[model samples]
Target chain A: MSSAALVELRDVVVGYGELPILTGVDLRIDTGEIVSVIGGSGSGKSTLLRAMVGLLEPAAGAVCLFGQDLYATRPRSRGRLLSRVGVLFQSDALFSSMSVLDNVMFPGRKLTDLPDAVIQELALIELARLGVADLAERMPQEISGGQAKRVALARANVLAPELVFCDEPTSSLDPINAAVLGREFTRLRDDQGSTVILVTHDMEMVRTLSDRTVVLAAGGICAVGTPATLERSEDLDVQALFHGEPTRESQESKRA
Target chain B: MDVRLDAIRPRSLLHELEIHARTRPAVLRLDLSALRQIDSTGVATLRAVTRRLRRSGVAVELHGATPEVMRVLAETPEPDPPKHPPEPGVLESLGRSCFAWWSGLLTLADMVIEAMQGAAGAVVGRRTFAWRDVVEQLELMGADALPIAATMSFLLGLVLDFQTWVQMHYYGTESVVLEFVGIGMARGFAPFIVAILLASRTAPAIAAQLSTMEMRQENDVLRVMGISPVRHLVVPRLFAITLVTPALSLIATASGILGGLLVTVWLDPHWMAAFETMLREMTLGDLWLGTVKSVLFGWVIGLASAFTGLHSGYGALSIGIAATRAAVASILFVMIVDSIVTTLWTMAQ
Candidate 1:
C-alpha cells in the first residue's frame, strides 16, 4: 500500500491463449530491493516477471509502474516504459549474429539517443563490470553458456534501468558463474540502488542473494517472506516442499 | 454494475458524462433505448478528443461506440497496429504454408520465371566473375565427367556405325556413313545427348552441395559475414558450367566422329574420299548451333540447380528433398528452355 512502490501488481491473471496459467497474483517491488521468486517449472515465475515488464498482458488486474498502467499505454510509450525495466531472457537471447560488445550495446541503442562513441564506451564499461570485456568482439556462439549469460546481464544493466528482471539467468551456468552473477545482482541492488527481480528456482541463489523471497506453487503465491522464514515455515505444504518430504499417506502406502 | 471513477481531468463535465462513461471509459457509449435524450456536446467531446479509453476494462471494443466517434477514430490513421492475427481457418492456414502441394505447383511455375531471370543474371554476372569455386566445380563436375561423356559418345557412335554399315553394305550406300555421323554430331544430336547427361549428373551434384551448405546454415553464416552467397556460390558454378559444358560437348563430338571415322575406314576402301565429300557438304553454322545449345544448356542447368539448393529449407529431410527436386526440375527446365530457344531460333530463320 506504500506510495513509493516502484511496481505493483494487483490481482493479476496471465495466460497464453485460452489456457489460464497464472491466476489472481498480487506482488509489489520497491526501489533498490532485490526480490527473488522461487518455484519449480510450470509455476509461472517467469510469466509474472514478463507481465511486470509489460511483455505480457495480464488477463485480470492492474500492472502499475509508478502509478502508470503499463498495458493501458500505447506500444511506443510502453517501450519507453520498458526503458526503465531491463529484462534478461531465460535463453539469454543475445543476437547470435552480433559480437559480445554489440550485444551489450543493444539496450542502449534501443533506449537512448547516445552517440556511437558513447555507446561503445558504455558497452565496454558494462562488459568490464561483468569481467568479460576481453570477449567483446567475439560472437555469442564462440562463448561458453556462462559467458553468454553474463554478457546478457551486462546488456540488461547497460541502460542503468531502475529495475532489472532476470529469468533463469544462472540455469546453464556453473556454480562459479552462478556465484559471480549472484554478486553482480547484489551489487546492482545495493550499490546502484536498482530494484532486481530474479526469477529462479536456484535455492542457493535465493538464500544467498535475495533481500526478500516469493514462492510460487501451482501459479499462485504460496509463500512470501524472508528466505529464512520461508525455509522455516511450519505449514505442511511449505515444510514438505522445502524438505523434499513425501506426504504421510504416500509414505504409509510405500511402507505397506 | 458498480464502477469506480478514479479521477477526471475536467471535473465540471464529470457529473454529466459519469452516467455514460463510468461503466465503460472516458470515450463510451450507452444503448439509447435505456435512456432519454442525451447531450450532443457530451457526445461530441467524447467522440472527438479522448486519448485513452476502454470498454468494460476487459477488451478494446470501440467500434460501435458512436458513429461520430468511429469516424474520428478512423481519421486517426494507424499505418501499423500491434497486430495479433486470429487463428486461421482451413484455407487460410494452407495458404499460409510455403511448401504446400498447391504452393509447390506454384513454385514450379515460379521456378521457370526465376530460371529465366537467373540465366540472364548469370550471363551478366559472368563477365567480371573471378572465384576459386569455379575451378573447383570444373574439376569436380566437368573434368571428372569427361571420361563418362567420352566413353558414352564413343560407344554410341561405334555401335550406330557398325549397325548401319552391316545394313548399308548390302545396298552400297556405306559411303554415306561420313555424312550421317557428321550431320548428327554437328546439328543437334551430340550436344543434346551430352547436355542431358550432364544435367542428370552434374546439376544434381551442384544442387546437393548448395543444399547441404544451406541446411547447415553455412550460407547464412556467409551472408552474416557480408558475403553474397549468390556471388560466392552461384556465380562460380555458373562460370564453371559455362566453360566446362561446351568443352565436354566438343570432346564428345570429336570422340564420336573419330569412332565413326574408324568404322568407315574399316568397312569402306575409299574412307578419305567419303570424309572429304561429307566435309564439303557440311557448313560451320551446324557446328555453331550445337555449340550455342551446349553453352545455353550449361547456363540453365547450373542456375536452376543452384536456385533449388539455395531456396531449400532448414531440415535434413528438406535438404535431401531439395537436392532430388533440384536435379529433376533442372533437367526438366533445361529441356523446356532448350526446346523454347530452339523453336524461337528456327522461327527467326
Candidate 2:
C-alpha cells in the first residue's frame, strides 16, 4: 500500500442537537485497507461512516479525503469528489420504483457519459458478478432482503470507486450470503484497490475481511488494531465489545 | 522561496490552492500576513496544499499571518458561516410564490400528458401503463365518494329551492323556480359542490397515501430505479379522478333535481305537473358545462394532491401536513378554474 493516507479524521465530534454521538475521534486510513469499525448500538458507528462520507458534518474537527477536506469544499466540488466514493446504506436504500437491473445502473447513469447499452451491459455484469443476474428484472419490492443487499452491493461497486463505505452490509443477510459479501469485500480491495470502511456488528466479517479493526465505545475509539490484537485488548470496554458483554457504564445506565 | 497566498474565502479558496499546488516550487513560503479572514475551506486548503507540496519534496513554510488568521488556521474551519437561512423580503417571497405557482402549473401539464400517454399505452397493448391501479383509484375516488356527494347535492338543491320559492311565489312567478333550480343545480351547484367535497375528501386521502409511500422510502426506491413516481403513481390517480368525477357530477345533478322536485311537491301540492314541464325545458349545454367543470376540478384535485404528497418532507407529521396542504391547494385551484370557465362560458353566450 502507498504511504499516503486516503482518509483522515481529526478529532471529529458529530451529533444531532446538543448531544454528541462521536466525540474527538482521530483516525487515519491508508489507501487499499479494509477497516471494520465495530460498536454496539448507538455507539456512533454509522455516524462515523456518515461523517466520513460527507453525509453528516462533524460538529468539530475535520474529515479529509485524498487530502481534501470533504465537508469544507464547495457543494459542486464535493459532489464531484464524492463520485469516487461509494456508500452502501444499512437499509440497502434501493430505489423501490425500479427493477434491480435499473437500480444497479443508477450510479453509472448518473456519473458516467456512457451509452445506455453500455450502462445496461455494465449493470448486468455487476449483477452477474454478484450472482444475482437472474433477479435483475424484478422490482426491489419483489426481491428478497438478501437479493436486495447484493443488488445494493453491485450498485455501490458499479462505479469502481476508490473508496467504499458499507454500513452493516451483512446485518440482514443469511450466513451464506454474508460469507459471499465478505469475499466480495476482499475481492474489491484486492482487485480494484478500493479502500473499504465497513461499519458492522458482525465480528466474523471483521475477522475474515478486515486488515484492521476499530472498536468504538463511549462516542470515541476505544481500540484500533488487528482483530486478533483487539481480541486481547486490556481495556474493559474494548474487551466487553469483543466478548459481547455489557460494559460497566452500560450496566450502570441500565440500573439507573 | 516566498509564496504569496492571496485572499482566502470560502468561494474559491480550494481552486486557488489547486492552482498554487501545480507550480511545485522547490521551497514554498506562504505569506498570510495580508489574509484578513479565513473560513474552514481556507484552512482545509492550506493543510491540503501543505500535504501535497510535502509529497512532492518541496519545503513549505508559513512566514506571516495576522493573529485572527492564525487563530482561524489553528481551529477547524470557522463553523461554515452559521448557515442563516435567508429571510425572504416581501417582493422576494412574491417572486418565489409566482415561480412555485408557475412550476406547479407546468408539472400539472406534464402529469396530464404522462397520464394521457399511459392511457394510450394501455389502449395499444403496452402493459407499462397500470390499468389495474387506475381501476383501484377509480373505485376509491369515484364509487366510494358517491354517497356523501349525493347527500350534499340533494341538500344544496333543497336549500336553494326553499330559499328562492317564497320570493317567486310572492311575485306570482312560482313557475320560474323550476328553470332556476334546473339550471343552477345542473350548471352551477352540483359540479361545484361535488368538486369541493372531493377536494376535502379524495384529495387528502390521495395525498396521505402518497406521503406515506414517500416516508417509507418507496418513492426513493423508484427514483433510484430511474422511474418517475409521478408517471407511476400520479398518472393512474389523475386519470381515474378525471374520468370518474364527471360521472359522479351527473349523478349529483339528477339527485339535486329530484331534491327540488320533492321540495316543490311539499310546498305546493298541485305544482308537480308544472315542475316536470319546467325541468324538461333544461338545456343539454348546462349539463355538458357541469360535466366539463367537474372533470377539470378532478384534475386539479389529483394533480395538487399528488404533487404535495410526492414532495412531502420526512416523518409522520409531514404526511398529515401534506394531506391538509393538498386539500387546501386543490380547493383553491378548483375555485380559480371554475371562475375562469364560468366567466368564459358566460361571455361566449
Candidate 3:
C-alpha cells in the first residue's frame, strides 16, 4: 500500500429509482486506514458502501478507485476494481447452498486463475485466520449465527482485498465474538496494511477498532473525530447513541 | 407437593425431563399416569435424567411409574437419525453444470419426453412454491404484460379488419365481413395469435427478471430465510397468468369483433343480418373449439414462461438471452400444441 488514497468519492449523489438516498456526500479512504462510519439505520451507510465498491453508481458525482474514474471504465474493468474491495454485507450474505469453504473460495476463484487445490488451500488458510477452519465442511444451516458471521468474514478476506467494507459487523454477535472480530479488524489494518471502512452502530467497536470515526445522522455527516474527541465533543446526537444505548454496567445493575 | 399428569409428558422431551429434575426437590409425591403413554420419546427422556443423576453420583427412586411404564422403558430405545446429510459428493458437484451433469445430458436426449414427465410434477408442486415471489413477479410480468399485449392485439384486430374490408369490397362482398370475422377471429386465428402475442411480450420478460434476481443471489437469500422459491416465486405468476391470459384473450376477441362490426356496418346496412345468418351457418363446434384453444393457450403461456424464468442462469446478459429464448420457445410450443389439438379434435369428428 502506497501513500496514495485508495478510494475517493467526490460530491457523490446516489439514488435508487426516483428516490435519492445519498446527497452530495464527499468522503475519502487513504491507504491502510481504519475509518468507522456510524449512522442510524437507513441513513445511506450501506448505500455509501455500495457506491465505494461501484455496485451502485453515483448519480451526479465521481467515484475514483486508485485515481481511476469508476464510470469511465468498462463494466468488466469496473468489476476488477470491485473485486479488490471486499464487502461483508449487513445480513452476512452467505450462499446457503455452498459449504463454508466453497463460499470463501468463490471470490478467490473469480479474482485469480489459481488451480483448484491452490484456491482450496488459500481458502482454508483464510478460514483458519478467521478461526472458522473447523466449519469448512459444515453447511450454512448447521452453523450458529456467530459462526456464520465468522465464515462470511473469512470469505470477504479470501482475496486479501486492499479495502474491506463491513456493514454492522458486530451487531448480532455476543460480547466475546464481537471482541474477537474487533481485534481481527485492527490486525487487518496493522498487519496487512489494508484500509477498512466499518459501518456500525456499536460505539465500543468504534472506540476500540477505528483510528478515525465519522458520525452520520439524518442522512449527512454530523461530526468527525477520534474516539476521545467524539466522547468529549458536545454533539447531542452522537452522545445519545453512544451512551444512551444500555451500557453493560446499567444492565448488570438492573439485573441486581 | 404432587407432580401433575400433564408434567409427565412434555412437548419437548429434553426440556420436560430437565424441568422434572428441577421440581424433584419440591414434589415428593408425583403422579405418573402420563408415563403409561411414554413410548421411545418418554424412555429417552427418562434415560437423560438417569444419565445426568448418575453422573452427579445421585441415586434417584421413582414409585409412581406403573408396571407398563417399566416394561416400556425396558423395550423402548432411541435410534440416531440416518447419516444422510447432503454432502453432495465431489462428483455430484462437478456434475452440476448442463454440459457435465447426467440429468442435463438426459434432458438433451428426449426434450419432449422429459418435459411431459416433468411438467405435471413441476406445475402442481410449483403452484404453492415461491408463492410470494411469484405474486411479486405477477405484478411485474402479468399485470404489466396486459397493457402491452392488449394494446398490440387490439391494434392487430383493427388492422386486420381494415385490410380485409378493402380487399373484399373489390368483390362486392361487404355484407360477408361477419363471415370472415367469425371464422378468422374465433376458430383458430384469435387464440393462436393472442398466445403468440403474450409469448413474445411477457414470457421473455419473466425469464430475464428471474435470471437477474438469480445472479444477485436473491433466490439464495429466500432459501436461507427458509422460503420455498417455487411457492414464493413461481406459484403467484402461474396463478396470475392463468387468470390474466383468458381476460386478455377475451379482450382481443372483443376488439376483433368490434373492428369487424365497424368495417361492415359502415360499409353496408345489411352487415348485422349477414353476421346473424353466418352465426347460424357456422357450426357451434367452432365457437366451443375456440374457447378450448384459449384455455390450452393460457396454460402453455403460463407454464413455459415460468419454467424459463426458474431455470435462467446467473448473469445479466444470460437473463436477457433466457427471456428471449423463453419467448421463442413458448411461441413455438403454443403453436405446436394448438396445431396438434386442432388436428386431433377435427379428426375425431
Candidate 4:
C-alpha cells in the first residue's frame, strides 16, 4: 500500500435504502492513474463510483479523498477538496437550458478565477478537441447522444482539474470517437498528471488504455490487476465475465 | 516584439492589458507602485489577466508593489470576474432571440391545436381519445380538490357578506347585501376561486409530472412506440381540467351562497325576506356566463402548463423550474383572459 493514495475506500458498505449493493468494498486509486472499474450488469459498479466520488455516502467504514475523510470533514473543507475533481455522469447531465458553450464553460466560471475570455477560450479549445465545437450553440437536447457525451467530456476537462471520474464516457460514441476519447484520457493523465477513474465495461478501453483494471462482482471488488493479468486469471468467474460467458447472474437476469 | 517599457499605474489596467495583447507584446512589465489598496478580487483579477496574457504568448511581470499589496497578491486565488462573458455577435444574438420566440409560439400553437382535437375527439366518441386517463385525471385533480375549493369559497362568501353588511348597515338598507353576495357568487367569485386555486395547484402538478416524464425519457419511449404524447398523455389532462373546472365552479357557487345565507339569517330575524331577494336576483344567465369563463380558464391553465412541461429542459432542476413557470404563466394568463372575457360579455349584455 503506497502512502500517497489519492482516494482510498476501506471496508466501505454502500446501498440504496435497505438493499445493500456493495459491501466491504476496499480499493485504492493512486495519483495520475487511469483506473477502469469493470463489472457484470447490476454488479454495483456505478454505485462504487458514486460512493468513491462522495455523491453517495458509505454505510460503514471510511472513504478518504486526498488524505481527508470526505464525509467527515467540515462542509467547507469537503467543498475545497471536491473543487479539484471533475465528473462526467453516465446520463451526460448537461444543463438543459444552457447552450453547449455555456455548459462547457460552466466549471471554469464557478470554480476558477480565470477571466471569461480565458475561460471561453479554454472551453472552446476543449470543445474543438472533442470535435463538438460546431455544436456549441445548440442546447443539450438538440445534440445526439454521442455528441452530448463529447460535450460532457469537454465540460469535465475544461478546467483541467486534478481528479476526474467518468461513467460510461464513450458508451454512445462510435469506435473512432471512443478511441479519440481514450487518447484524451491518456493525455489528461500524462499532460496534466490528473487521476482518471473510469466506470466502464468497454473492454477495448480497459485492455488497451487503463493502468489498472478492477473487476467488481457479488458486492465488492473481485479482482484488481492489469487487464492482461485479469484476463489470464485462474478465477472462472473472471474468465466468464471477460469472455461474456453466461454465469449464474446472467442466467438469473435472463430469467428475470 | 519585446514591448517591455510599461510603467502605467492606471486603475483601468485590464483595458491596457487587452490593448497590449493585440500588439503581440513579447514582454510586459507593470509598475504597481501607485496601487495602494488591493482586495482579493483585485489580486485574482491581476493574476487572471497576467495568466491570459501569458497564454497568448506574452510574459507579464509585476514590480514596485508594497508588502501589503504583495501579501494580497500572494494569497490563494479565488473566483473573480474581470470581464463579462464575451457576447455573441449582434446578428447571432438577434437570430437566437427570434428563433426562441418563434419556437415558444409554435409550442403554444401546438398545445392549443392538440387540446382542441382531443376534446373534440372525446366528445365525438373517437377511439383516439384517452377517456380512461381523463377519468383518472378528473379523479385526481377534481374530486380530490373539492373540499379545498368549497372551503375557500365559503370563506370568501363570509368575508364579502360581513364587509357588505357593515357598509350597508349605515344606510338602513343592509338587506341589499344578500342580493349582492348572491349575484357576485354566481357571476364571478366562484369561477375566480376555482380557477385560481387549480392554477396554483393542478397546473404545477401537471407540469411536474410531464416534465419528469420528459426528463426520464418516458415521453420519448411513447413516441418510439408510435404513440403521440400529446394525444395519449396531454389530451387526458386537458379534457379532465376543462370539464372539472366548470363543475367545481358551480359547486363553489352553491357553497358560497350557502355561506352568505348563513350570515344573512344570523344578522337578521327576517332571513326569509333576504333569501327571497337573493333568489330573485340570481339569474341563470349569470351562472352560465361564469361557467363559460371557468372553461376558458381551465384551457389556459392546462395548455400553459402542458406547453411548459413539453418544452422543459432535461434534469430534476429544470423540472422544478418548469413547474414554477407553469404556475406563474397559467395564473397570469388566467387573469388576463378573465378580464377580457368579462369586458366582452358585459358589452354584449
lDDT of 1 by residue, A68-119 (tens): 7888876446655666777777777676646999878766664567886899
True-contact fraction per candidate equals: 0.00, 0.07, 0.02, 0.00
Docking class of 2: incorrect
| lDDT tens digits by residue: candidate 4, A1-256 | 5585799998999988778899888888889899999988899988888777666788898889899888898655766777777778787877675699998887676566778899999999999988889998999999988888889889878878788888888887788788878988999999989999999988889888889988898888899999888877756567766777747775565467
In model 2, residue pairs whose N, Cα or C atoms come closer than 3 Å (at least 3 residues apart or on different chains), thus clashing, are A95-B221, A96-B221, A96-B222, A97-B221, A97-B222, B40-B77
Backbone clashes for every candidate come to 0, 6, 15, 0
TM-score of each: 0.45, 0.53, 0.46, 0.49
- Best TM-score among the predictions, by candidate number: 2
**DockQ of each model vs. true complex:** 0.02, 0.06, 0.02, 0.02
lDDT tens digits, residue span B117-187, model 2: 76666678754456777899889888898998999888888888877888889988777686688788889
Clashing pairs in 1: none
Q: Listing every candidate in turn, what is its Cα RMSD in Å to the true structure after a full C-alpha superposition?
A: 21.6, 18.9, 21.0, 22.4
Per-residue lDDT of model 2, residues A143-207, tens digit only = 88888889888998897889988999998799988987888899899999999999999888888
Sorted on TM-score, best first, the list reads: 2, 4, 3, 1
CAPRI classification of candidate 3: incorrect
DockQ top scorer = 2
In candidate 2 chain A, what residue range of length 10 has the lowest lDDT sum?
A246-255
